[model samples]
Target: MADVEYEPGSEAASNILKDLQEKLQTDTELQERAQELILNIQDIRASVNAAKAGAGTHRRGGDEVQLIAVSKLKPASDILALHAAADGGQVHFGENYIQELWKKHAILPTTISWHFIGGLQTSSISKLARIRNLYAVHSIDSAKKAVTLNRLRPDGFPVVNVFVQVNTSGEDSKSGVEPEVDGGELWDVISTIRKECPKLNLVGLMTIGAIARSQAAKEGEENEDFVALVKVAEGLEGRIEREEGVKVELKLSMGMSDDFESAIGIGAGFVRVGSSIFGARPKKADASIL
Candidate 1:
């Protein structure tokens, strides 16, 4: 695979597209799926905004909820097809594996904003940082990782946007800090990022709610896991201002395709949708269900 970066529509990109024409031609179905999903996300955002307007208080995340098309294991041709047809907002794609992200980042158009939304390995921090088009990292769990990521940011690029992952599900299998005000783990991590990591922007908080909670959310019930993450974001708001001496409006990244609608209703600023948009992957049983 070529590791050279290419501008959209550049000769190199055109050549790549030429080489992948067969794949792109077959991606019409993928494009339709993505477009439909985009429309659904927009409709949900609009409905949520309207509700917030009526309630006069529910608004918390940003004005819009961003969708990150999780493209792990999917071919780059599929991404380009989706990008060509994407409407309404930026073409932000999420990847779970560092190596896959690295390779795709090398080949994909620079216009596509790549977000790392999986577990972060200390050894791969350098490679992850080397990605010039990295829009954000949604798996930041510790102060140590934050410091290393910040230190290794490519020279002259803008600070990386990052979400402090909080294991709201309280699952030992998840990677995140405890979202407890009393325990101070959440505060400690965010405070560290705010004070210590100059190259990282403390953008928001993310969580992979328990599968049961996600299912429950679809049945018109609040996902306790998402509720916890929102609380964490809320708690951080006052503290970020009072202690950090900066007015930071932390957002929430707590939804997948399964429960993204409710998450948006609850003020989630970012939602990662994969299977719903791309169909199931090669390995459904994989533990990293980002």
Candidate 2:
């Protein structure tokens, strides 16, 4: 695949679209699937926006809940199709695998904002930093990784926006700082990032919540994890403004494919949706590319 970056509608992108057209024309199944995905995304976007309107948060200059299409394990063609389906092109897409994201970033139009939404190793900071269009990173778990990313930011780029991941679920296997005020662990992480790393903007908090909590949320049972994240955000509000020396909307990014609407209703500034738009991904063994 070509590694050169292209602007949307440029000659290179046009060539890519030509190839995409050929693929879609030859594969009826893929064409139908792509169309279906586009409709699904549209519906989800409307629902999320509507929820935000009714939630009464946007009235105070709060950020509209952004839809980040999680594109991990899906083909780049799927991303391109979704981008083309929208008028302004899809502004945000999230990827977990570093190598896979890099490959897609190299080929996709630079207009698309790529967000790294996975557990990141400190070693990969330099590589990810080099991505020219990385809009934000959503899974920053520690002060160490945040410092590493700040130190390695690519030259000439503005600050890299980042979210401190809170393991609200309390899963031992999860990657995030514990959201506890008693010990001040979360405070230390956020304060250290803000005071020490000028290259990284401590923009928000994110969490996966517990797997069991997801079912509760689906059944309309209030998710304690989600509630915890909201409380964490509220608690940090004054500290965030004080530390930044300017009023900043410390966003909460705590929704997924299943409960994004619920998340939006609770003032989530961003929601990550994947399978509901792209359909089920193939088995892990099917993942190739980089």
Candidate 3:
């Protein structure tokens, strides 16, 4: 993709964003894009709808499924093009790096609802909390991180949505709280969120399940990782209601580009799609979070 040339200034964000979106929406022949870079908003939306219609496990109805465009290694221009392709309505985007996330947030329209879907750590907690338009955080794996994030959230701001990441696949490389919740680490953190973290809204459970699980779902088998996430959500909801005296309906965030169709079909509240919507992204060797 060619570098997006636009005037720089605080006032120029919406203007530039709108201008780029208009041009891209109209497919104005300004620059040729790689075959992999083509934005396919229509196809992605249609596929999501189709999957929803065929959903056999959607618990809360198909209309509740939401798509979070996982634009991790993609550029701002591609985001603009996709936004334009959706007639400026598809605004939710997922990012991995705190640094890249903020930089893009600074340049893009604040109307965009950003979801941080990468590993959350102590070093980047404050910066992530400071994002003005952050819609949700899908990688909160620890209680301390959750507490600190809640404390760092700007005063008077609406509680930012939070999803407790669970390592359902039990993969050593994955980052999430363990699936156990019977007075274990997962239970402790969830309790902390409901009782101590007032600035954070515990909205759902998220997981980066094994690729094998994704493939298995496509083959008409159960994605145990997703099933585990749903179980956790149900367990937490019951516990929270009984102990904390708060009625809560936790959502599920377990689908990705590879298995989103099956995930939505299983009634996931949010599906993070990347390559299918914005095309394949080159690998990030040393992605910065600061």
Instruction: Highest lDDT: give the candidate number.
Output: 2
Report the lDDT tens digits of candidate 3 across residue range 74-126. 77776655554424457899999887787777667777889999998789998
- How far does residue 269 in candidate 1 sit from its true spot (Å)? 0.6
Q: Tell me how far the alpha carbon of residue 186 in candidate 3 is from the true structure, in angstroms, after superposition.
A: 0.7
lDDT of 1 by residue, 1-290 (tens): 24454433456656666665455556677556556655654565465456445434546764666778888987776676667653644489999998778767656667889999999999999989987779999999888899899999978987799999999988899999988864566777788898888888989999998878777554556789888888878778877777757777888887786777677767788888887677778873453211
What is the TM-score (0 to 1) of candidate 2? 0.86
Clashes of each: 0, 0, 0
- TM-score, one value per model: 0.82, 0.86, 0.85
Worst 10 residues of 3 by lDDT: 1-10
Name the lDDT of candidate 1.
0.77
Q: Which lDDT value does model 2 have at 197? A: 89
Candidate 3 is scored at a TM of 0.85
